[model samples]
Target: MSAWFAGLLLAAVSVLVGCRIADTDAVTPVPQLLAFLPWLLVPTGTGLLLALLGRWWVGVVWGVVVLAGLAWFIEPYGKDSEPSGPAVASFRVLTSNTQFGRATGALLAAVRQQRPDVVFVQECDNRRCDIALRRELAVAYPYRQSVDGAGSQGSVILSRFPLEPAPGVPAAMGMPGAVADVHGHAVRLQLAHPMPPVPGGLGPWRRELERLRDFAAAGRGTPTIIAGDFNASQDHAAFRRILDTGLYDAARLAGHDRAPSWPSRTTPVFGVQIDHVLLTGDFSVTRARFLTLTGSDHRALVTDVTLHRR
Candidate 1:
């Protein structure tokens, strides 16, 4: 019995260590094993709880171990802070995963109401091209780049400012990466939609993450903004890789830690902020919040950011 208990404790420790390692690299596959660890230890944790009232030191130790293991599995919370600069002077950006050509009117209305200086739309479909929506947005956003086609499960960035598209920045399969220079601000935007682990495309998803890292690194000196449906949660390896690049997550930086933007129309259970906007360089986020659901699986992420003049 003692030997069996020791084996269980060892297993818990191993799972914690594996999760930590996975957090360090975006290329690493999501640790599905770690996700199941808590379920496996529930019985042990309950036993420890019962034993604690009876003054069992063994139970106390097991409780500590279980708590520690659970803590390791959770993502560390960011310290909350107020926006640094003038919120009114900041440039507003809205990013939404459109679920590929659904609810054109609602999508257009959301964009028009927000009037963000820059808008990033994901899951763009070729068949249901909303020409009227495009025309309406064109009035405000003169600069746009969209690859709406059958093969191109890509994204589009419509900007109020002059947008000069960088070469090789077109959307691609899996994680569609794009970069655009917004009014001389070299904002590197990546519309990543990484494949989920269960679909046997984890390798391709990791490769896409590697590609995004290389792209972001290539534009090291400029102000970079990467946003989209990363598919990977905050706890996943792919999301951590972008964070490791020394860029600030706009939402976290603005003090909205519990904000989850995915599955927009659904409840919080389906929402976990798979959509994100990350910034690097001399800029401060004024405010960040998830917008109302626009009939899609993911909520729109709107951020007000001020770029400090050099």
Candidate 2:
């Protein structure tokens, strides 16, 4: 095959990879592929390989397209100048799906080690499997809340500090979470599990994202921080809209977005990041990273942040 033909294929695939992320009404029917955008790097690297095959100019063209994509779509976050301030308080927060039923002792061990001030669990709705964790968690987190939805993995939040469920406030996130009273500052914390943006499921996914955005607008009685399996990444336009509303992804802030969190690192190269810890402008992320979990397709997300009174 001609080197030009190979280069052409690379450029064509590059464009296809770049156009997968969308968050709008116009493309509601499109399959969500942003989660795999990082794989585009494969082609970016291929461009370099093309030059070795003697298609130097074609390689240059392919390289330009892929690099521009990296800048335009996957730019490294946390490169922005950080806000200077004396942190009112710093705390550790952890969010994990806990898979379905594998609530092994390793989970408890990690929690004990991390000593997260706030913990959010998704898919623990199977009372027999996940809800049972209440006893183990209570040892470390005296304040706890969990909602075993009718089915699936219900959500739960365990905190070392006082946590109160907001009355008359509706989050419509389809799971349970709580408002944390941190040293007199009320921080509305919610565990979000939006519907996966799969074919025939995009509508509900989009709606859930919009609801979270609306909830943010309805005047949270206190600052809010949402952490859970978002099911969608910043590559999704819908997720980006949520972040634009003064909320920040701690992983992005700590330069961890490039790291994938799902599909298990057993095949690390193919995994994509779908889980996140989102906080409002009320806090500045101090540290963020993923934690290894036992028997989970997802890698647990852990973050530390300093609260800001605005």
Candidate 3:
């Protein structure tokens, strides 16, 4: 019975590994499953131990193979990279979802403590908390663009520098973007909060991710940054497709991608890194880390980036 159970567990893990590699994430449950894909290593390792105790050589070999494949999928995350060249401009960014405006005060305090040049906030609903945050934010960030939405749909961008609404860019649901004038150069910023893949939301979630992919593909000519609660992780095929468009994740570059950024209620070990800061053009991330928000489910992602001139 132990051998049989181990074999079945290994088989299920193999199927999951295959689906992730085949990019079947657009389908329901697959996207949801992949969100916690890295966690599968625990069970696969347990199955290998069980197989060994039962003298199930076939199960042990299969378990080893499956575990190896799973490791390959998770290896790139948190990998460090060396800086390339001279910096034209350097800035810090803080991005977070405020949990329907519940974390507004904490978010504001983080802004003052981190002193980020730009802030990307999702779930900036028009409640008393959010309204107060915006009013307080304007004292430091004179340039801003915000669109209030129902519940957790609103998005906002606040910058210490000048900002202009980006023109001619295609729109995705709940994504608010702008162009910031940093040292006389234009840096495009997009605050993204795609629909989560809950029941009845999978289609919209896929479409929203596709839209961001298209947006990234078309904006290769300029320095662009997209930050917020992506509602998808690097394990998702749609999110990986966006990276294929030439954007680099800040956490990945700085060797901190493994630090989970969601479910702030629990310890970091129990959460997943769903919030992200992605960049394109000649930019290099110098530092990346996360900060817990008082009343939010998602932890804020803070990154330092150096933008290189062409």
Candidate 4:
């Protein structure tokens, strides 16, 4: 019976490790399941116990799984590097999914407290919410871009710097890119709020992520920042492809990527870090922190970033 149980545990670990490598979430529910990848420690420890109870093979197999999981978890930290050029500008960014704008009050309060130079909000749907947020945040963020629709089709970018539509990058699915003039330098800022990977929505979700990859690659040498509720974590191959285009996650750069931001307040223990602030081309993250916003399931992500003149 112990052997049978040990074998089952080994198989489970193997499947998880395989998923981590292959990222079988393109059109499946793997992303949702992979969000809980850190929980693999439970089975790993159990397998080690079985080995101590005479099943040495269980320990050997589980040991390999532990190594693979550790490597994946630490991969983000290695991707971050220091800026190689002279400093140009420094600022803070905050991003959040406002649960369809129902968390407007909390989001505003967070903006006031964190005082981010730029803010990206997803699910800020309806016109009334947009007007209210604009009015509330006018004093700090005079420059703004808002794309409104019903349900999850809305997104907004508020910046202290002057903003203009990024002509080089086209809007893809709900993602919008803009150019912000920071101290006379152009910084490409994008708001990312792709379709949720729900049943029958996987295709759109994957395509949106691919577009983001292309968008990042299109602006080769410019300093760029993409922030919002991506609904996909680093564990997903789709999201990683976006990073492949020279972008590094701000949280990862600060070695704080493991701080979960989703499903906040409720089911707080089972949350995953789905929201992100990704950057490329002469940028260094000084710090990253997550803030709890009332009425929203996701915690706001705030990062301090410095851009370098290369």
Candidate 5:
């Protein structure tokens, strides 16, 4: 009976931890752990082991509770069923930080292999980045903006499609942003490399996230995609609210949500997903996944999306 009660208690705690992640604000480091709520599975799994020692019924109840939490927290990344109809237009997009403009070769290789229609690169405001951009991406991605000398305030956008400053935005604001004409579909895109959520930087991080949220709110009807190292995860409240602003996380939409994209050297199973590609409007995510990239602490995210008929 003691074992059974302990198991039930553990199970309840695990469930709460998992559910509360999305609501966890970045006030202090404690609640910030919510960004890694999936890790709660470790404790939840232990509770299952403890319950089995008590009785079959108790074990079963604990199992159901634990599994329910897993399903809820991870369902966004769950495998998706096949779609019935065809889409009107489709294209590939990639977002990579380039690790402060250090991973030139790796970035080039990934670009060559992925062959994305549009690329959003953060930390690209440097000399080495410019050399690589001219040598490797110049001919391939003809329409480029803020590619070099973008500064810490914004990012660079390289695209095969015709790229221009987003309409009505006077100047490039918080994030590196632009609008790309993808086979006639004008899609708004931004490279969002917000300040990290470290102790000293929490204040700036919150403001950066709020800026993105405001962008999404203002661009309600436009097809928008915000992609980069958000530094916050699906569990963070501010990040979740950004999604609530009408953007659908590409990985989430395609049920590939568990694929982590940061701290690249760590095991994919345990790494936190800080990189993301979020979309709004009639974009349908057909494929989304994180890929290995050498020379950077972060992994790259790619997504194939199909647009609805206008």
Candidate 6:
């Protein structure tokens, strides 16, 4: 019986290690696996504590390792810091994860009222990607690029300033998408929606992260802004990998780290902030907050940023 228990414990530890390795940029689908790690570890840790305590040092060591792993794997916020960079006039950015096409009217109203210089909309289908939305948005934004269609699972960017398409960055497992350089600033904008790992769902989220990191790294000379639903939260290791690549999260920088965005209608006891806007280089965030729900499952995120001309 002792031997059997020992074998079980070793298997549990091995599985934990495998999970950690998979969650890295290497395996690409590990982020999805991370959601289950907490529940998995609880039983294993209890067994280890009860059985190994006779060997007190062994139990202590195991406890430390497990706790450390949890801390490293789960991160809920980007690094905390006050806004840097010289103060430039604030420019508003509206980022919304529209549930395909349900809240077009509400979105149009927000756009008309706020008139943000840049707008990022996710989960937009081609049916709603018509001239009316464009016409209404055109009052404030003159340039736009959208990938809306029956098979569309990405986003669009509308800017008041001219936008030139930058090179397409290869995604981890899907076709590459476009990134654009907004003229008149030292910043470039990348809009993406990486595939979520839902069991047999899109199998590789890491590939998306790696692709985005590679694209951001190539443009390190200029400040870059990446906005999207991302699907994964800041607490996951996948998000940490992106942060490790020197990008700053604009929402956290603006003091909105606890802003929960998912499930707009029903507020959970503990909310999740899955929508995000991350930045790199010299741009500073002035404000980042969730907008009122407009009949979508996810709330909108708006950020005001200031970029210095150096």
- The most accurate candidate by lDDT is 3
TM-score of each: 0.78, 0.83, 0.94, 0.90, 0.80, 0.74
Cα lDDT tens digits for candidate 4, 35-107: 6567666776676566657657746666666657746664553376677889988999999988877888899
Query: Candidate 4 has what TM-score?
Result: 0.90
Model 1 agreement with the true structure over 1-310: per-residue lDDT tens digits: 4435644554554455455555642223334433233343565565465556556676567667766766655544333333344332358888877776574556788777878888777766666533644767778887776655542375677777776656433335434334555556556555555554444656765666666666677777766777777665555666567666656678878776447675566535444656778777456877888866555777778998877544
Clashing pairs in 5: 77-255, 77-257
State which candidate, 2 or 3, has the greater TM-score.
Answer: 3
**Number of residue pairs clashing in candidate 4, backbone atoms closer than 3 angstroms, sequence gap of 3 or more or interchain:** 0
Residue range 209-300, candidate 3, lDDT tens digits? 88888888888978899898888888888898888888888998888767788788774878678899999847888899899989999999
* Greater-lDDT candidate between 3 and 6: 3
lDDT of 3 at 168: 23
- Alpha-carbon runs more than 4 Å astray in model 4: 23-27, 48-78, 167-173, 266-269
Model 6: per-residue Cα lDDT over 1-310, one tens digit each: 4334544664565465566656542343444444444444565566456546455555546655765666555444456534455655557778877676566677787777777888888766557733446767776776776664533464577887677766544443222233444445545777767776565554466667667777777777676778877776665666667776778877778766656777676543345677788877466787877876566887888888776654
Off by over 4 Å in 2: 1-31, 44-63, 77-85, 167-173, 267-269
What lDDT score is found at residue 112 in candidate 4?
87
In candidate 1, what residue range of length 10 has the lowest lDDT sum?
Answer: 26-35
lDDT of 5 by residue, 1-310 (tens): 7476656667555545544644556356634556676776666666666677666565668666766766676545323333344566789999887776776678889999999988888776567765678778889998876634544444578899898886322223335578888778788888787788777667777878888888889888777888888888877777877888878888878776777887888848678888998887567887887888787788888999887753
lDDT of 6: 0.64
Number of the top TM-score candidate:
3
TM-score of 3: 0.94
Better of 1 and 3 by lDDT: 3
Best first by TM-score, ranked: 3, 4, 2, 5, 1, 6
Query: Candidate 1 regions off by >4 Å?
Result: 1-17, 21-60, 72-89, 129-132, 168-184
lDDT of 4 at 267: 40
| Angstrom error at residue 120, model 3 | 0.3
